[model samples]
Target: MALTTGQHSWWRPLAGTALVLMATAVMTVMLASGTEIAGELANRPLDSEGTATWGDIGDTALALLSIAFAIPAVLLAAHCVQHRPMGTVSSVESRLRWRWLAICLALALPLVLFTVAVQALMPAPAGKSGDLAWAGTPAFLTGLATVWLLVPFQAAAEEYAFRGWLLQAVGAWCRSPWMAITPQALLFATAHGWGTVWGFTDLVVFGVVTGWLTIRTGGLEAAIALHILNNLVSMSIATAFAGAFASDDTAADMDWAAVAIDVPMVLLYATAVLWVTRRRERANGTDVPGGPNTSPPPPTPQTAAASRPTGYMDPAAEA
Candidate 1:
């Protein structure tokens, strides 16, 4: 219904890209205006804030609100740039698949909890704080509350921007899903400013997985669920035990053990999600991810040439 009203087309991606960057810059500057520490920290980057106090958490959360602008940025792009309803970014159905989202959360929660438990057991690096027992304290409660209230929005904003918006934007321009997935993942990792090789690679992998899920499920629900669960627990832990988790992981340390652990975990999670979803799709006669399995019509030479579309023709089409 919405697509019927606008001058939307693949050509709008360029406009959408510009709008997203502008929105991000404007929001960050606005949000950073009142904070004294924003400039200082922007100048002196942290290995990842060692200041694990309530004030620190609140400030960090506030800074994160800048990234949160990406959600609205996407919407503005959808309406103003793409000239389509913003809901198109969510899926072909133009709505969130909440039922699928709930199932994804159920599947993802156990793995996230397991990852946290395993991470807690890893040896702390030198200069890392180990005094994490902040429970039963006013600070802990404040930090916990802040994270619960804000992390969902923060994580959702990120998913919508990278996996939801960028993925669709790039997909509009390219036939292969990898063409869309790769750039979005790269941008996502770079945006984190992880600065370390391990951090960058880890985020890139995370982005790829989420991007793939978006295409497979034809929506952002699964990606948003996983991101919120992963970040909410992880940030809350950091908030509660600010000094407890310490690592010089901000640097370019290509920690193979950490990478090795995560690669398998990602694969395991992907396999589980697909296996379950595939079973459901088959048993219930429903669409999952890539839509139904109806075979595509065989291509004709004329149709194949036409597939490139007019005015958007490849220069090498004659070849």
Candidate 2:
């Protein structure tokens, strides 16, 4: 939101958005091409997919890294066009709040695990094989290793682009938070590519929820945590189930049943995170922005005092 608060011409955000798109495209292509060249030289043949899939370590890593290019692209656009610190795209605090991010990650793990359990208990879609086999130990280990290493950055790149960059870009022109939030949510859903109507709606809901959480928390940490965990779990499951990744199914392909489960899981996470943030603010005696659920905890008293101008005296102390 601070990106929107600065004094600049109206065209700045528009220009920044344009730069982001161009930069993302160029960077992704170059990165993907580089990966392919490296793969060829290594005799591995890494072909980047149009969409992210879990077929193999090479393909999976390519998909993630291709998308991950958005981070530097967005950051560059923010700095060059908006004249703001790259970190401001991360949070109103101008940098990642590691403690808050960790808290959200902790809150997300159980809920995601519970969702996976529920999915496991549910019947498989009709006509789709319910049977699953172990991907051989070596392949499985390699897949898992790739996921753990790249999925977090891949997921964070998305949050940085959507909830972080796009949201703030829109915010720069629009005074209303929803005005900023809605466009990015819709765009996020669209980026996943359309499948079933239910799945599309579900993706939209995910965007909206995560976008709102980004605003509520005054940072992308909440959204990023949820996304990273969701991708990690989903990809891990696919890796565990032999041949599952060969199929082209994505979140966009989810049926109503999947949507029903996913929608509520994200909502629950958002609610619980909000509660935790509120509790943190209260415990720290920090000013809560917006309302009870708002974020980027205000400076502590000692921090506040230390930040005051030289020789400045506190009126309360003088009294």
Tens-place lDDT per residue, model 1, 92-183, is 55667677778888888888888777767876545555555654467677778878888888889988888877777776656566677899
Q: RMSD, model 1, all Cα superposed? A: 7.0
The best candidate by lDDT is 2
User: How much lDDT does each candidate structure score?
Assistant: 0.68, 0.76
Cα shift from native, residue 55, model 1 (Å): 2.3
Error of 1 at 211 (Å): 1.3
Clash totals for all candidate models: 2, 0
Q: List the residue pairs that clash in candidate 1.
A: 216-289, 217-289
The ten-residue window of minimal lDDT in model 2 covers: 307-316
Evaluated at residue 214, the lDDT of candidate 2 is 80
Q: Candidate 2: lDDT over CA atoms?
A: 0.76
Relative to the true structure, candidate 2 reaches a TM of: 0.84
